[model samples]
Target: MIEWFTAVQVIVALLAGLICLVLGFIGKQPNDLTLGSIVLVELLLIAQLVVTIVAPTVGNEPSGSLAEFYIYLISALLLPVAGAFWALIERSRWSTVVLGVVGLAVAVMLYRMGQIWFVQGTP
Candidate 1:
């Protein structure tokens, strides 16, 4: 895992999380802006997944435990994908809340990725 990529993911997730929280509070119904932001965050997660795959192949294996990395990698992509789909179907404030949780989960996953990458004998 690249520190730079994980850092970017964390930053984008934080911004998206903040936006989702505000939208969840103020919106009458979930709108495109909220949906769009959620999609963008999902895209970032996909990028991270790609990097995670390529990095190990190219000799940049992180230092974290494999189990943890696998869990984080899978969850990072799955959460937002599922949340966005659910939000699309739900069409309510709950959708925003779902996105918000997705954002938060991605951020936590990034932090986990960081710990895994840097910790001794972990990856």
Candidate 2:
């Protein structure tokens, strides 16, 4: 995994999360702008997933233990997609809450990813 990409994702996730909360406070539903932000975050995550899959095979040093990387990758990749679907199912405050949760999770995963990447060469 590219540490820089993971860092960028984390920042993006945090900004999205804050937006979700603000939108939720202003209104109980997500507006078009909120939806657009969600889509952008999803695209970035998909890109991260693609790069992660290719990194190991392309001579990049493996980040952390392989098992850990895969676990984080799958969960990080799933959260936003699932949240977006769930958000559409209910156009209420809860939907925005879900988005916040997903964003927070993505940020946490990015931190974990960084830890894994940096710890690989340690004894």
Candidate 3:
């Protein structure tokens, strides 16, 4: 729910997505760089999870629908896992593209989550 933290997440997700997209386009297979970036993004998501858990108890409660925010958060958490698993299973450049897509998706979702937390009546 913290704006600065959400900004950080969005930036990292964007970088991850860009990196994977570039690698995929360059014909690079899924490797440590690609996988590691996804891992980094996932770590940030975990941090966001912790922040969301602690924020409410500390009086930084969301202004929008908590359920909607949580749904976005949970879905964002899943994308990287699914993308990484698919990359590992397929071991293809296209899998790298999939990871890129996942990263971008998480970024957009995080932005929406911020809206859901701070801007009421978002639809």
Candidate 4:
């Protein structure tokens, strides 16, 4: 649960959200650029997940409840995938809106994960 990496994830999520919202406002469906951005964010999240799992083994366990942290982690990991799938199926501007909303949600979840891991203080 590296704090800086978590911050990066949050930033990326917000950027993706903004991009998607702008595209939606302009009546554009999810395009390669939007989807690619989401994918990049997703990959960062996967790396975060790996670090979260490996950190505990290396004496960096989170202070918060492991179960709660895992819940947030899993949700953060899945949101982009689900949103992308929905966007592909719907093929409308609203699909981009859906992605935008999902991105925002992911950002919030990442922040929560950080609170769970760092703000609570090391155990």
Candidate 5:
């Protein structure tokens, strides 16, 4: 995985988390802006998944366990979707809080994926 691209994902995820948290604190459900941020993050994750799949064919495999890395990747990809679904169902400020938690988790998982890509024995 590309370091710079992964860093961008991390930053975006964290920012989204912060935004959701702030909105929740202010007693608001997720609005379009928050939903848009989540969508943006999911798009970035899909791009990363494509890169991960193509990189190995181009001889750019991860240094760490590929299985573990893939698990993280798949989990990261699904997180936002689940969170968004829950948020929609709940339709409350707490739903935004759930999204905030999901965003932060995605950020951490992305960072872990980077480590798995570049650092050996990272599992």
Candidate 6:
């Protein structure tokens, strides 16, 4: 639940989402750029998963519901994989749009995860 790492995730999601969105708008099919963005996001989420596991052991335990935090983290981890598979199967501009949507969705979910882990129910 490190704030700086969460910020980095959010920024990456936003930039990838916006770029894919623009590509889709221009009628581009799911290309390397779109797929690469998903790969990057998935890698970051995997790293975040590791951090989440280690953070508690290091005494950086979450301030809010641990169950909720895990749920968000797991869901965020799945989005990019699913999006990439969908794009590979479909191979259309809409596939690129799906990537964009997943990126944006991950960004929002990450924001909420940060809240649940650090800021929720605190004075």
Highest-scoring model, TM-score: 6
Residue pair clashes in candidate 3? none
- Tens-digit lDDT string for candidate 5 (1-123): 888999999999999999998998899998887777888899999999999899999988899988999999899999999989988888899989888888899999999999989886643
Could you tell me the lDDT of residue 14 within candidate 3?
93
Q: What is the TM-score of each candidate against the true structure?
A: 0.89, 0.86, 0.96, 0.95, 0.95, 0.96
Candidates by TM-score, descending order: 6, 3, 5, 4, 1, 2
Q: Which ranges in model 2 have alpha carbons more than 4 Å from their true place?
A: 120-123
Name the weakest run of 10 consecutive residues (lDDT summed) in model 5. Answer: 114-123
* Lowest summed lDDT window (length 10), candidate 2: 114-123
Model 1 lDDT tens row, 1-123: 778878888998988877887879786356787778878888887877788778878998877576778787887878888888898888998789778878887898888788887775741
lDDT of 2 by residue, 88-108 (tens): 888898788778777778878
lDDT of each: 0.81, 0.78, 0.93, 0.89, 0.91, 0.92
TM-score of 3: 0.96
Task: Candidate 3: list runs displaced more than 4 Å.
Answer: 121-123
- What does the lDDT come to for candidate 1? 0.81
Which structure is stronger by TM-score: 3 or 5?
A: 3
Candidate 2 local distance difference test against the native: 0.78
Q: Which stretches of candidate 5 lie over 4 Å from their true place?
A: none
Model 6, TM vs. native: 0.96
Write the number of the candidate with greater lDDT, choosing between 4 and 6: 6
lDDT of 6 by residue, 4-50 (tens): 99999999998889889999989999999989998898898999999
Steric clash count of candidate 2: 0
lDDT string for model 4 (8-107, tens) is 8999999998899899989998899788888888999999988988999999888888899999899888999999999889899999988888888999
